[model samples]
Target: MVVSLKESDFFSKNRRALAKWISAVEDRLPEGLEFLQRHYHRVGHAFRIGITGPPGGGKSTLINALLRVFRARYPEETIAVVAVDPSSHLSGGALLGDRIRMDAIGLDEGIFMRSMASRGSLGGVSEATADICDLLDIYGFDRIFIETVGIGQLELDIISLAHTNLLVLSPECGDEIQAIKSGIVELVDIFVVNKADRQGAGRMVNDLEYMLGLRVYSGEDWRPAVVSCVATGGSGEGADGVFELVEKVESHRSWLQARGRWGRKNRRNLERKLRQNLFHYLQREFDFLQPLLEQKAEEVEKKRLSFSEALEILLEEFSRQFSSSLKKRKGG
Candidate 1:
């Protein structure tokens, strides 16, 4: 049986209820949209940070280190993490669940961690990621971290949802200039070089600094800072440069807030979210035109009609049906 949850349950910070609602949203169920609508007013309180990079870039370890720093700095504040993992083809579940990697952090009462499967999203994030972030914000978490699966050229969906986007890199991923060119470098607010203890770390930093120097940013004078860190806290050595990384992130946040860009960014994010939701709704309702669409496809296959011509016919039929439905409603 599908579990039902009330809005009050979410407002009260009930983990079980929150988890169920997130699942519903991930599955694109109507109840989830309803819940989001009910609690829409409570969002925008938490600061969202998106961490993304190539596989083996140590994003998970970096996040784990940052979590420790956040807890120590703000002991009383709540923190939430949404880790996106590749989906398992057989089970359709998160392949690398949060509990397996960040078990220690999950044990903390002040920290809430949930893993979501990318489920074939090319951008290294799930479609429901922004919605889940909103729910966490409404739950009163002071900070929200969205860690995406391994990133590539088109993996820039995080830019639309996060206030600050961190592009993680590693020394072993040699030729930093070539690496940045392959990803969406312009959208990043900060660059983090994890595994700083490895060789070529300094060279990587220099390459990134040189590339960033060529960009001409408008309005504000905030330049993306490159910070080095070994995230594992290995034998009292892994925590190196972590404090600097955290400081740079906080500094960017303050810079955005000072110039009134924070609110503007949030508005832009809302617009993108609304557009995505509308597209999803239209896709869900496509069944109303599916039979006609199939017929149109067959016509195209037989060369009886061009693809564009068939599409036009399909749209005309859809418009007629939509008009009839509206007329019937008015008469009723």
Candidate 2:
């Protein structure tokens, strides 16, 4: 059942092909890494925007509205969405699948949406999120939206993966906003107050503005902008602040471009990605050392060796084994 897809199949504008590739990547199959190795050069063209916030902040609804606005504004361009949801305890699948929530948008041919389970990652995104986004980028989507599992203050990893980061907050958050101000404030590019029709919406925005004023930007010049939105329809039935929200996001993009920081940020993202992948690669390659590690741990537990002494013995063994394997591989 594991059929190898042709290179053309990946490059062709077929949704089915893209879905297959995404599945492979998420599952961490060898084919997925091979595909990435082959076509990674096709990346860096797509603009990645990350949306994250506290639970019940309407992040999903805001993303839905933003999709509509983007589609209308740029009909010729294609868009991709990667929504990360908390994992189900039993099955480890997405608990609140965004594909269902975004069904109101229907199946627009110009848009691609995929939902992923966070898989217990504390970073608010799954380990494979960046890889999936790279696949979407190589698939030729002009814009990619990454919606994180809403874990409030701990979702700072989005800063490393996205070009523009939007932190969606709501009036309902109340005192929770104070908890977020200490950490999330520094990473966000735009602070979006959704449910702007609510009573405390204005106060929330003002409080955020005041907090921004007190913080020093260090050497950075671009101050995070605060905006309000209802994240519903554009009609009078719901406040249409999403339009302004989109404008602010675009403005941030322009600012990044004008200051020539876009490429620099992208480079940093790649560097971090490379380092993460390297760590995983080493873990997989050295899994055979687990027994030796356990033995060392037992020696330390018995007081036969100190931690440093155990570590030194383990390092010698590791070096000897690794060097022997390298010689064997070269000789063969």
Candidate 3:
């Protein structure tokens, strides 16, 4: 059966429809792109929070705790979580399915949880992550949390999409300090030291404070807060810091709004999304030239053409074909 976007159920707060639309967008279907384009104006209402750090840093646990706190504090608001995990090499599915750790949140009707595979992307996120976030935003979620796969210095893509970014750290990870030194510290809005009950947690907090002190931040700028938490503990005993974390996130949101930076940030995010979509569209348009590209490769392998010569030929042919197609469309 063909599902039409014109159906009121598709645009309503229907979980099945939302899931179907996300899957279509992930697969890069034309109908999916059209649906998003039609509703582009409805985005930018939700507060996006990004959580990232090294593998086994207890990011999922921290999010689980945060979910409990948020649900308790704002029982009426809706929440959505997008957990990105490393992809399985053989099956191309999320390896860990972090949702398993968030089973408690899954039971809440106000909360929506999705697990996405990184698909071997070095940025710790999949290409369709931003699109999925957009869908969630338009679906009227009050808050959206995106947990990235294990990240490194260059995996800062989350900073562009999230209004506030939390860098999760663990006392058990010996490389925590080293990872911070790799430039990840500069990208985060909050530092969360999970597993505070373990040894070295205080030292990690001190190290982060010292690093922050080195940077000459303006007095008017928002200072990142470093909080400690034992996310795995029950009855909120280990999650004492979750409240402070929520407070800091709210403070940052207020700071951005008061300074008139929220609109600017949303515009910047939209620009990035536009650039990404244009690049992908160009790539799809170039698919027709693949056979010719292979032929050029064969010629180069046989020493009939140099690499540069083959590239020039391909570009010239592509330009000619593209121009002809434009003319045909105009005439028809």
TM-score of each: 0.86, 0.88, 0.84
* Residues 121-159, model 1: lDDT tens digits: 777787888888887888799999998888543257788
The numbered model that scores best in TM-score is 2
Ten-residue segment with the worst summed lDDT in candidate 3? 2-11
RMSD of 3: 3.5
Order by lDDT, highest first: 2, 1, 3
Worst 10 residues of 1 by lDDT: 174-183
Query: What value of lDDT does candidate 3 attain over all alpha carbons?
Result: 0.82
| Positional deviation of residue 20's Cα in model 1 after best superposition, in angstroms | 2.7
Compared with the true structure, what per-residue lDDT tens digits does model 2 show for residues 151-266?
76637567768999998888988777778746667678899989988999999999989999998875657899999888875523243788788789899899889989899889
**Number of clashing pairs per prediction, in order:** 0, 0, 0
Please identify model 1 stretches exceeding 4 Å from their true place: 103-106, 175-183, 218-221, 234-238, 283-308, 318-332
lDDT of 1 at 114: 92
> 1 or 2, which is superior by lDDT?
2
Best by lDDT: 2
